[model samples]
Target: MSPTTDADLSDFVFVRRNDGLPIEEIPFELVERKGVGHPDTMCDAIAERASRYYSQYCLEHFGRIAHHWFDKVMLFGGESDLDYGHGELVNPYTVLFAGKGAHRCGDTPIPLADILRRAAADVLSEVTTGFDADRHLVIDCRIVDHQGAGRGRSRYRPESHDDLVAIGDPSLVSNDCNLLHAFAPFSRLEQAVLRIERLINGPDFKARHRDTGWDVKVFGSRNGEDFSFIVNMPFLASDISSFDHYLSRKAECREEVVGLLRDTLGGDPAVLFNPTDRNGRPYLTALGSVADTGDVGAVGRGNRVTGLITPMRAMSIEAPAGKNPLDHTGKLYGVLAQQLARRLNEMTGKPVETHLFTSKEAPLDRPDQVVVRVHGLQDGGDEEQKIRAVVAEALANTAELTREIIVTGVTMW
Candidate 1:
């Protein structure tokens, strides 16, 4: 839906239906949430952190995040049995981290396998409730190198590779021509639900709501003034006793969430947790998440580039999470596209879609395509000139995009 923020529409294209209803005035809508426990998002977050931990390790020792590409990660969800408040995993996760990387710093082994496995354990613990990282799950971190315990091959044998050749490499550029966008003051409902999830998942929140697992997902929708949210969060069986007790705990969590949403959105919004489950059976996690059950997840299936799979708007399906933080356009341009969109919208007060495309090995700033689409923007108008100037300035400021991505961690989906 389009934004309702008041703006001068004199030079804008006022798009309206025959009924004269704005885009946000849809009578009905559908929104889905991919929980943090969901297989795909779990994989995405783990993979992202894998790169991040490695990047930090590299920067600390080698002065930069050396050549590591881990886009081939896979999450294998295991099976579990649950009745009421008790559940147990019969088969735990068979998570495999496979990909290419430079796993050495001048003969000093970087401990790639250890780092990736630690990354998995850290992420799994953070994303779930009562799951034991060392006992409840099986993790296999394999690097593509001729080393201790990796899978394939590293970049020309990590032992004797030219370190300086890999570092500050010009070929360390975007690998794909991508189109990314950002919401300038993002959608209100989006911000509200995300904030609510983080609030409920915080250590302070968990100290109170023990039944509320860390794997939280919030799906927000609006029908004009009526807003509602469907959250899919796994309830920890260790904290819950019976199905009735589980429901009661779930209700308490929902009530707390509803209060948060109501205050933020300034209206009463319906909040439901695990709405599709029956009374006798619900999403009760033996390990504090649905991943211990029959749910299978992949890398790119969870969130869009914006971190939420919002289908109603123009978005990139590129799984920016866990991709190479330095060179991959899927990660670098995800930030770039968002920056471009935000700046354009801030200057013009118009719904803008900023698209910048760059091929492999090309300069990140010198995009082959720099196209900005503004709603109601006329071609060759003075307003268009201002918009172009704004885009140019933003693009000029992106010389350090890669540095920012690796330093701050790639934050898109």
Candidate 2:
């Protein structure tokens, strides 16, 4: 059964459908989660933090978040030499920050350099342990003041703080034509992967096992009832004394993770930790991350807003990080779709998927399409009405959504 078009309004075409398959019922599923210390994720984190800091600075000085976009960020891994028990950084990691931002409000400077440095330092410190951003990383700022071609003029280089007052538009509009999809109730396998990674990176596990590194990636595949996970986790070189010591630590960590999987799924799932480990070489690093070991990364190449990269599910290719919180539907709609999906699911007690799309420069509250798929949608006629009411209410409150995003620093990558 396919979903039917329920309501077609002027601003949005709402489609409510049944026969949507739950993720678990889907025969095959693939979910990947890039850990915080992964270079790509690191870039996303830094970009988002920078945007938040920039927003705060503008709000404090100009009374609103000025027009800016800091989505382009790259982490060029440094060179590091490693052995069984020792590691040395030959060169420091380079964080190349490239994007457009508000450099000045009239004659007053926005202190972009100070904002970027603070953002990068804070994120790097939080993501990795035993690593100092100042000592082990170089910050490069290539941000400029410019907007796209048809945007009238360069809002980034505004004439005065007064010019920035209208930058946060009262009528929030989409900056780009983009689509976002989100669903509620993560599948059991998805939950398992999230839990496993959180455990590995959490403080208690880090305290218990000092050799574990934070640069972890979990790839989970499910075919029918059987599930398997390939976790690429790094081991700190300084914690291992010899080959035997490395094996012992690796074995211990694997056992713990296996136990976690078993507990999560209520079944023994096949688990492999650091499958790339060989005799002469191990998945070892100095600062608990491959980002400092010649591995490069950029934004939009990592996880989606839901924190997992699920190729099997409805997804958007847009990277939401660093976009302005006020009107960029790339960021706002992505977060809104997920929130609406969760709320609808909770309200109807059914698996719900929400997709929102808009045209470039369209009002944020007026999306071109809002497709809601409820697994048991056919059971009730009022469900469609409820869905419309919910979506309409949420859309009407997009201003609040923007405020929430700025205040909470909602995660979207």
Candidate 3:
């Protein structure tokens, strides 16, 4: 597809709605974020990294990305024992790699299982320090070579590079019917929740506080201008000396988080940590994540592509993790919707929600319908024209979008 011109604008719909209230003023808003080491987030990370490695291999060897989607990963937690100053994982965690991928191009075989295992190890090592991936993690590959539902066998089991349709037509064709919806200009409470999570998981915070674990979950609710958070943060058992020490460390961490939230939201918000803590029991873990024990997680159950699950704003049920970066509308459209909404919001100085819809085999650049809604829009004519330009340009440059997703490892969790 060529650069978008005036003619390309006709395919999209742009409207201005002034009735919808901004998220903060809407009375009741809810947002949840699963941190880096949460089991669900772990599955998302492993699956997406697996896809990235697979795509890179295909591009380096065959000059194009082969068909692959590893979005069905699962992490089954292992058995563990923990005390105030001692912890150990007796059984290793098991990561099951599911979905399908092209295993060969003509006679050249692809080492897909090895690539996936390496990807899992790389991500797991970065997220946890108590467990060694080579010794304490088991990587299993149940990924197959068959495309599900209506697609033919050759799609995932292609015999040659010529069978990879996307290689011939750089403007990839959508593999499924999907909808992508996203909004921009996060409210004060939403921004505060994100900032709090980052503050706790950041490197500087980790350096100062060694007792804190990575399996943090932040849940925030806002009623009008008042915001409150219930955070599930785990403490490393090996770092705490006694019950009093655990309580003291938690108090310090809570103070730091509340300070950050007050600065970000410009108000005093209530922050609670480990509500389940009792007289002699606290939230403690061996490997920083609950997954070091018997807890399990599956993909598509964690945070959305924006890194938070916001029910108050426009959201999609679709999960973008592990989908092919080239032709999978499930991944591409979601990422693009976010970018478009932010651009329009910045341009119009109003909140924006972008929705893109497409069907099976549709061209990547052209969706079946494109809807751009500007909340609290001041005027229509010229603003709508500008919105159309943004949509048209995005639709015309999907090839570049795919490249960015592959190279940068676009955020899906």
Candidate 4:
């Protein structure tokens, strides 16, 4: 066969190796996920939404999305005075939005600060729901460079909108070498934990249980056949009147949660609820997230781009938040690796670990290196071909992922 071109991706190589043991033989595994209410997850979410919304606004008004990635976002938690059944924010959260973008589309200047404020407010309202935007949140925007930066820096095309006809794709390949990895078939424990969290934060859950807050977290560990799950959730004091009521609610939540998990997964996983505090005082929060009382948040420090934090997996520590969804391989590779891992596992019907690396300016269609490690496939023959096909299919969705991320802005919960 001939060499593969950039668009064709025919030259891509896939290296596979045995995982030394069968998937079912593995003894222990652990997985963790930071909920949307986590400080770090909040930072990722706010920055991502801000960039995506601004890009959309520009695209609609100027015919092209102006370049901007507000990755460097900081949230300073403020004070909240609270008691059993009542609470109020003594000071609101202070958020700083710092990044570069085109402030002007021709002579008409874009509403820069307005965009920032709206973005921050909208994101907090959507992600951290029930949090008071006007009274309890203070958001500010500081553009790193008001002057236009290069396209690769922020993925802003150099050709002006006025510059009539143009050549090929306006976007360029990744400007830096990015390495990312993910594992196949999320453990049953991981899925169970995520489902419980989404349930707690969902509208139906809230409607039924008004006292339950949205800021919730899930951590799971497995020891042979035994499993342990730790859930951290706070209750709103205003919803419940007395200390007895608080304890009663807590007991009810614990029982129901344990029963739900047992029924859903058919396992005797020990469920621990809010073990951090036993001082007779219930954990109360004015909002769903922990940003209420001096919790800090930073980009890339929260969940992986796939929304689950698998400490055991060979995943990247780099934060994929606030990058241009269209061209930043940092974020794209994270999603790509995850999809490839799932497909490879389905192909071989075994636990799979997939890794992909791309050099600076390399075509996004092809990776500089691709590695697939399977945990004991029954048959080694034809595995390589099947793995390669799976990778090719995953890479093929690069454009689609880019478009979805840039346009819709996928959130990590």
Per-model TM-score, in order, reads: 0.81, 0.94, 0.96, 0.88
List the candidate 2 regions with Cα displacement exceeding 4 Å: 1-13, 165-168
**Which should have the higher lDDT, number 3 or number 4?**
3
lDDT of 3 by residue, 29-133 (tens): 899999988999989998888888888888888887778899999999988789878888889999999888888877899998799888888877777766687
Higher-lDDT candidate of 1 and 2: 2
Report the Cα lDDT for candidate 2: 0.83
- Candidate 4 local lDDT, 1-413, one digit each (tens): 12243344435565556656543356877777777777788888888877777767776776656656778888888787778778666798888877766666556677778877777777677655467777877877777544343433222332455421111143446646889888877777677777778777777777778788766888888777787899888877567688788878888887777877888778667988887667776778767667887888888887886677776667787667776665667777877777778777787787888787889878666668877788775456876666666677666557667667767656643
lDDT of 1 by residue, 1-413 (tens): 12212232222222211223223555654445565666787888888888888877877776656566676677787777766656677777777887777767667778788878887788787777656766666767676644334322334254433442233355455666676655443566667766776777777888887666656778888877788888877787666778778777778877888888878888688877777665557667777766777666778887765566666666677777777766677777777778777776787776666666667666544556656666666655677656655555554444366556656765555
Q: List the residue pairs that clash in candidate 2.
A: 106-159
Residue ranges of candidate 3 with Cα displaced over 4 Å: 4-8, 147-153, 165-171
RMSD of 3: 1.7
Number of colliding residue pairs in each model: 5, 1, 1, 2
Error of 3 at 410 (Å): 1.2
Model 3 clashing residue pairs (backbone): 106-159
Consecutive 10-residue window with the lowest summed lDDT within model 3:
163-172
Q: How many clashing pairs in candidate 1?
A: 5
User: What lDDT does each candidate get?
Assistant: 0.66, 0.83, 0.83, 0.71
Question: Candidate 2: deviation at residue 406, Å?
Answer: 2.0
Give the best candidate by TM-score. Answer: 3
Q: Which lDDT tens digits does candidate 2 get at residues 153-177?
A: 5477788765664443655577788
